[model samples]
Target: MGELGEVPNQLQSFRVQDAKCYCCNHSHIHPHSGESLPCDRQLVYETFKKWWSAGAEEGSEQHLERFNTLVRQRVAPKVARGLGIALPFHYVVYMAVFCMVPWLSDFIALWAETRDHRAAVSMWSLRHFIAWGIVGVALLFALRMCVWLWKLGSRIEKRLDSRWCAVFIVAPLSFFGVCALWLPIGISLAATPEDNPLPVFLFIAAIAITALVWRAPKWQEPLPSKQPSPHVFQRKEDNATFSI
Candidate 1:
C-alpha cells in the first residue's frame, strides 16, 4: 500500500502560486490586516484532496482551515479597490458611470436650456455635438467589451468562484442603496418607453448576460464508475446456466 503518512505541509501546501498580490506590493504580508483568495478555491480543493489522502485524519482539519485562512488573508484586501482595468475592476467603473448618468443628463438638459442662441444656430452645429456624444458612448462600450473578453480569457468562466464573479454583480452598485440590483431593471423599464431606448436596453441586456454567467450551475466531475471483472461475469453466467 502507498505510504499513508505522507501528509501535506500546511504552511506550503494549498496556496496561490504567486509570492504576493498582483496589485499590492506586499505579497508576503496581508493586504488588509493583510489577506484571502486567488490561492482561494484551489486551496480548498487541494486541502480536501490532502485530507482524503491522509486517510481523513480529523487532526489535520484545523491545520487545513488555518493555512487556508492565512494564505487567503495574504491576498485579500481590506476594501474593494476595483483597481484593475480588466473585467472584474471594470464593473466598478460601470457603477461609477451609473451614478454619474443622472448628473450627466442634468448637465446636458441645463446646457440645452441655457443656450438662448439655439434658435439662431444651424442644425449642422447641433448634429456635431450629437455625433460627439455618440462617439464617446461607442468608445466606452468598446473598451468594456474588450475587457469583458479578457475577463472570459482569465478562465473565470470555468472557475465561477472567482472574487469578481458572484458578489461583484451586486456589491459595487450597492453604494446608492437602491441601485444594487434594482438600477439595471429600472433603467431598462424607464428608458424603454422613451424614443431612444437603445443604450438602456443594451445595459439591461449586458446585466442579463452577466446574471446568467455568475448564477450558472457549477459542474463537478462525476466519480468514476467501477465495472466487475470479466472472470466474475463468466462465473456468474456459468452458475446461472447450470441452475437453469
Candidate 2:
C-alpha cells in the first residue's frame, strides 16, 4: 500500500490500496499525484469536496440537497452514460465465450485421451465419472474467463472518450476476428455429423444465459454515490471556527 501523501488531497478520502481507475485503466494514482482512484470513487470524492468547500454545512437540509443536486447533475449521468455504452460489448463477449466453452472442454478431453489411451478407456467405462470431472473443471474455467473478459471490455470502454465511435470500429473487427479464428474449427467439426447439433445447443444456452444476466436486477440498478460522513464535515467546521 502507498502512503496517503502519494494521493491527491481531493481523492485521499476515497483511496483504496491497489485499486485501479476504470476510466483510465490505471492504478489509483491521480495524474498529478501519481496515486490512482477508481472512477466512481473519484467522482464521489470530488462531489463531496465541492459541496463542503462551497459552504454546504453538514447535517443541514441545504447540505443534503446540494450534495444530491451535485450528484444528479454531475455524477449519475456520466456513470449511467458510460455503463450504457459498455454493457453491450460485455454481453456480446460473455455470450461468445459461453458458446465456446463446450467446444473447449471437448478439445481438452480429446487431448487428455490422446496422451494416455487408458484415459480414453476410463472416459467410456465405469470410471466415466473422471471424464465428467474434467468437463466440470473446464466449465468453471470458461465461466471465470467470461467474467474477466466482460470486465476487460468495461475497462476498455471507460478509457475511450468517443465510445460510440470506438464501438462501431471495434465491434465489427472483433466479430470478424472471432469468426476467422473459429472458421477452421467449425469446418472440421462439421465433417463429423454427430457434432452438428452441439453447436446449436451451445448457441441457445449462451443466448439464454446472456439474457438472464442482462435482466438481472443488479445490472439495472444505478451505481451508488456514497455521501461523506457527517463527522468529517463537523470536524472541518470546528477547525474553521477555531481558526477564525
Candidate 3:
C-alpha cells in the first residue's frame, strides 16, 4: 500500500505518458505521421499537479471549479486579447464590405446629380471619402464592441456558477445573423423594380460563407479527469493509505 498523499505508481505513470495537450486535449503527436507538435501541456500539467495536490478531493466538482478558475485567471486574458486583435480584421473585411452594399445606389445617385465632367469627378471623389469615413467609424465601433464583449465574458467566467465564456463566438454569429436579415431588406427597400437582385443574393451568400469560414476563438474547458478510477483516491481503512 502506498503512503498517505502519495500518488500510485500506475496513475503517476499514466499522467506522465499522456501526451494530450492539457488545455485543449489536442494530441501532440500526429497519429498517422508520428510528428510532434507544441502545445500548452507542460505548463498546464504543472499547474494541474499543483492544484490537484491541494484539492481535498481529486475529482470533485468543487476541485475542478477551483482549478478552472485558476486557469482562467492565467489564460483567459491572453485569449481575449488575441481575439480582440484578430476578429476586427475579419469584421473590417467581410462585414464592412457587405454593409456598404445598401448605400451603393445612393453613391451612384450622388455622381449622377452632377453631369458636368469635372463636377461629377469631384462629386464622385467626395462620395468615396464620405463613404469610407462612415465605414471607418463603423469599424471603430465594431472593434470597441468586441472589446466590450470580451470584458463581459471575463466577468461571466468569474461568477462561481456561470459557464458561458464564449461571448466572442456569440458576437460574430449574432453580427452575421443580423446582417443576413438586414442586408436583404435594405437592398429591397433601396432598389427599384428594375435594379438587379444580385446584390441581395450575394449579400446572403457572403454572410453564410463568412459565418462558416471564420475561425472564431474557442475557450478551452477544464481538463478531464486523468485518474484511472474513482477508487484511486478513495480512502482505504484497512491499509491506512490515501493514494491519488
Candidate 4:
C-alpha cells in the first residue's frame, strides 16, 4: 500500500467532490460554471427590442437616451409595427399549443403502458378515456371563451384598459386552484407513478404563461386631442383665413 512520500489520489477526489459548482445545477467535481455562465444581458436585449419596435424616434437624442435607460431597466415598451402584428397572434398560438395538453398526455401514457403490457393497459383503458374526454370537454369550453376574449381585446384596445386581460387570468387560475384541491386525493389513489401528472403541470404552466402574456405593458390612454367632441369641430366660418 505504500509508495515512498506519495500523496493519496482518494484525498484529492474527496476534495473535488466537496467543491461547489455554480452552473448546470450540479454538485462540485468541476470548477466554477462548468457549463456556460448566465447571460445577464438577455433581459436588456428583450427590452431594447421592445422599445425599438415601439416606434422610438431615431432623430431625437432624448428618445435615444430614454431608450438606453429603459433597456437598462429591462422594460418591455409598447408593442408596435411588426411586434404589434405578432402580439395579436401570440395568444392564438399559445392557446392552440396548450389545448393539446390533455390529448397528448393521454397518448403518451397509453403508448408507454401498452408497450409494457397489453392486459394491464386494457384494464384502465375505458376509465382513462372517460377522464381525457372530460378534459377535452373542459378544454373546448375554455378555448371558446378564449377566442371570444381575443376578439373582444381587439375592440377594447380603443378604450385602453387591461382589466379584461386580468379578468381572463383570474378565471383559469381560480379553476386550477379549485381542481388542485382534489389532486392530492387523486394522486394517492393511483396504483403506479406513471399515472396522469402532466395535467397538473400543464395547468400550472398555462396559468403562469397567461399571466406573462398580460404583463408586457399597460395599453396607453388615447390622447384627448385626437378624440375631440363632435361639437368642437363644428365651426361657424369654414372658409375664414385667420392668420396669427
Candidate 5:
C-alpha cells in the first residue's frame, strides 16, 4: 500500500477544502470522491502557513488575531448583533416614557381640578407637584438601573451563555409591565387616597394584561416526541455495513 502517514494529512487538507469558499464565501461546492473536500491543496497549506507565521502556534499577537478573525468570519453576525444591541438602552428610553406616564396622569388631574376653579387652594397643586416630583426621581433611578442592566447584559453576552437571553430580554420586559401597572395604581391611590373608582378599574386592567403577557408563551412551545425503543437495531452477520 501507499505510505502510512500520508492519509491523515491528506484528509486534513480535504477538510479545509470542504469548508465554504474563503474568497467568495459560498457553500455550494462539492468535495471530491474519497476526499473530505475538493479544492487546491496548496491554498489550504498556505492559509495555515500564513496563520502560523503570524504567530498562531505560541503566546504571540498573530495567534489572537487569527482566532478572532476565524470567529468573526464563521460565527453568525446576528448573534453578535443581538449581544451588541443592548436592549436595555432601548428600554431605558421607553422607561423614560413610562416614568413620565405618572406625571401625565398628574397633569390631567390638575387640568380637571383647575377647569372649574380659577383660584384653587395651593395645597392641592403642591401635593400633586410633590407626588410627580417623587415619581420623576424614582424613574430617574430606574433609568440608571436600566443603564446598569444594559452594561451587565453586555458582560453576560461576552460570556456566551443562555442566561443572557433571559435576563436581558425577558426580565426587563416583565419589569416594564409590572411598573406600568403598579406606578399608576400607587399614584392614583396616593393622589385620591380613597374615593376614585376609575383609577382602580384602570389598575386592574393593567395588572390583567401583565399577567396574560407573562404566561401566554408557555402554551405556544411544542412538546418533544417519545424516544424510540432499544430493540429497533438488530445486527446482521451477512449484511453488515463496514467503515473503511
Candidate 6:
C-alpha cells in the first residue's frame, strides 16, 4: 500500500458549493460521494494521466470538471481512507503490487527448475552451448517484442474509452501473452528440429493482435453528446463483507 501514499492528517471538511458527485460512467446522474471516503482511485487516475500526458487539455475547466467527477465517484475514496481529506481529489498512480504475488511465486518455481537443469548441463558440450545461445537469443527477442507491445498498447489505449480499450486491446494482448508464454515450452521440446514452427506462429499471432488493436476504432459511432445518467454507489465502510 506504500504506492497508495500516506494518508493526510487534515480533518475532513465540507465544500461551500453544493455540487454533488455524478457516477464516473454516467455524467448527469448524481451519486452519494461524501468527503473522506473512497480513497482508492488508482485506475481512474492512471487513465486520466495517460490522456493528460498525451497532450489532452486536462487543465481546461471542462475536462477538469469531468475528471473531478470521475475521481470522486470512482477513485478517491480508497486513497482517502484514514486521511482527513476533501472530495474531488486528484491522483494518477494505480494499484499494481497485488500482481506481484502470483508472478513472484511462479518465478521462484521456474528458477528452481532452471537451476536443476543447469546442474545437469556440461559447459564443454557443443550441444549445450548451442541450446543456451538459441534460448538466450529467443528470450531477448521475446522480451523486446513484449516491451514494444506494451508501449504500443499504452499509446493506443489513450485514444479509446476504458471499456473499448479493454475490448480491443486488453483482451487480445492477454491471449497473445498466454500464447507467447506457453509456446516457449513447445519451442524447447522442438529444439532438436532444425525449424521450430511454434515460434513463427506465435510471432505472427502477436503481430496480428497488435495490428488489430492499433487499427480498431477507439470508440463506436459518436452519438449526441448529452449528459449521462449517474448511478449511486453504496459505501462498504464497515467491512461487513469479507473479500479476498
Q: Flag regions of model 6 displaced more than 4 Å.
A: 1-124, 163-244
Candidate 6's residue-wise lDDT over 14-99, tens digit each?
Answer: 11122232232233233455433332233444565566454655443333345545545444444454222211112101122232
What overall lDDT, based on C-alpha atoms, would model 5 receive against the true structure? 0.43
lDDT of 3 by residue, 1-244 (tens): 0121122222223322223332233355555676774555445545666766554555443433444444344444444334334345555667766877777777777667756666446634543434333443344344444544555555455553354445545467548754554455455434634234444454445445445434444332233233333222332122211112
Worst 10 residues of 4 by lDDT: 1-10
Ten residues in sequence with the least summed lDDT for candidate 6: 8-17
Off-target runs (Cα >4 Å) in candidate 2 are 1-85, 89-188, 194-199, 216-228, 232-244
lDDT of 2 by residue, 1-244 (tens): 0121122222323312123334444444455777645555446445655756556455444544455446545665455445434335455556655656666666566556754445434333322232233333334334433443444455455667555655565566555644443343345334534324443444344445545544544322244344543332322211111110
Relative to the true structure, candidate 2 reaches a TM of 0.26
Instruction: Report the C-alpha lDDT of model 5 over 1-244, residue by residue, as the tens digit.
Output: 0122123223222222223342222222433333243334335545666765644455333432343344434442333333333234456557666857755775667757674432334444544554454444445444444544555554455556666474767467647844765577566757674334545465446535644533332211122112212222222222211211
lDDT of 3: 0.45
Report the lDDT tens digits of candidate 1 across residue range 90-208: 67457546755555564466456655554423332333233233333433444444444443434443457565663455343233433333445445444443234444445445456
lDDT-superior candidate, 3 or 4? 3
**Which candidate number maximizes TM-score?**
3
Query: Whose lDDT is greatest here?
Result: 3
Candidate 1: worst-modelled 10 consecutive residues by lDDT: 235-244
* Arranged by TM-score, best first: 3, 5, 2, 1, 4, 6
**Taking the tens digit of each residue's C-alpha lDDT, what string does model 4 give over 1-244?**
0121111222111211122323323222234546445422334434554655556454333333344344323322221212223244456556655766758776667756665555545544543553443343344335434444444454454345665665565567546743553343345335434444444444444455445544545333221121112221221221222211
RMSD per candidate (Å) reads: 19.9, 17.7, 15.5, 25.0, 17.0, 17.2
Off by over 4 Å in 4: 1-123, 131-135, 147-244
Pairs with steric clashes in candidate 5: none
What are the per-model numbers of colliding residue pairs?
Answer: 11, 6, 0, 0, 0, 14
Error of 3 at 99 (Å): 1.1
